[model samples]
Target: MNGFLQEKPIKNFLQSMDEFFSNPFPNSAFPLTVKETTTANLIIAELPGINREQIQINVYDHHLTISVNYQELITEENTQQNFFRSSQTYKRNSRTVALPYPIDEKKVKASYQNGLLTVTVPKQKGKKIMIEES
Candidate 1:
């Protein structure tokens, strides 16, 4: 009786983990590189087999978020045996970065080429505010 109770929880845990890993985005994190320059910060991410339309980027409260989702469909047929099979695969990932210093979000730029994503964030210039003597 005790063994049955313990086995149920173990099976449930394994099933949950399988469901979590089925979607690669939240389970696996991709690799990236960041470089800082005098005027701007550059970020490079490696994303192979992904199209520009499958990716999304957003900046809010000094944080930059990059997300991507791609799907591929495959179908196979056997004429002699009269067999047909169809399968689908999906790849996804998301990454968020925190800027070291304040950035000019309006001036930020990004580009994707050769399976690499590059983002340039320009630093915000300090504006001097004049104080009047009372």
Candidate 2:
């Protein structure tokens, strides 16, 4: 069956091409390794120079997003300067990951340690999903 009268999304072929050209150099996302546990999916992100206190995690609209914000101090020692130059820089990065299925938001657990952020999203106790013939 042809989708002649059905409403389409806002994205089209031209829009996709425009978006790709607009963002030439994409930002490097957090290096993450996702694994399935007994009850949940575990995602570990390797983010250096991120403070534990600055890590933010939230669950919204059945989606989970984690943002990390921190500052790194860089001191120039050999720069031909009479005084040392120290600069503090701030960077913020976020990642949005969807669960395999609907999950209990209250059971989400996240922790950060040694520049690594670990997240545990538990699987929901769900009813048997069945498809019926129309």
Candidate 3:
């Protein structure tokens, strides 16, 4: 009975840890905000601890995508004992949003400053179709 009781607690603890790590970002790593104007749409993303060089933005048709890729390398050495250790970590995050109207790809603009990324997408003009009487 005692053995079974101890095993149950261990199993429960392991299961809880698994659940926690499975969904590391329960909400999201970064918060995102989108605004729409009369002629353009604005997208703002908060990316802390990320560099401008690590961010990528793409605009296609009515879809906008933001991707972030970061890499870190750590090295430790002990000259006296001739020991060395090195480690590298890589993380990637991405988000895609759909615009209400077709975007003018040529007029899209993006900027990154102080860990904040902003993208401006202009709306494409609609073509008027002529109707003919049969």
Whole-model Cα lDDT of every candidate shown, in order: 0.84, 0.77, 0.84
Model 2: how far is 56 from its true place, Å? 0.6
Residues 1-134 of candidate 3 have per-residue lDDT tens digits of: 65764697787987888899997766465678999888778899998778888898887777988988878899999999999999999987789989867777788899888888999887677789999999
> What lDDT score is found at residue 78 in candidate 2?
62
* Candidate 3: segments with Cα more than 4 A from true spot: 1-29
lDDT of 1 by residue, 67-96 (tens): 988788999999999999999999777899
> Could you give candidate 2's per-residue lDDT for residues 1-134 as a string of tens digits?
23542335544655677888987555656777888978789989887776778878888756788887767899977656657778999877788888757657788888888888898998777689899999
Query: In order, how many clashes per candidate?
Result: 0, 0, 0
Clashing pairs in 1: none
Stretch of 10 with least lDDT, candidate 3: 23-32
Query: How far does residue 89 in candidate 2 sit from its true spot (Å)?
Result: 5.5
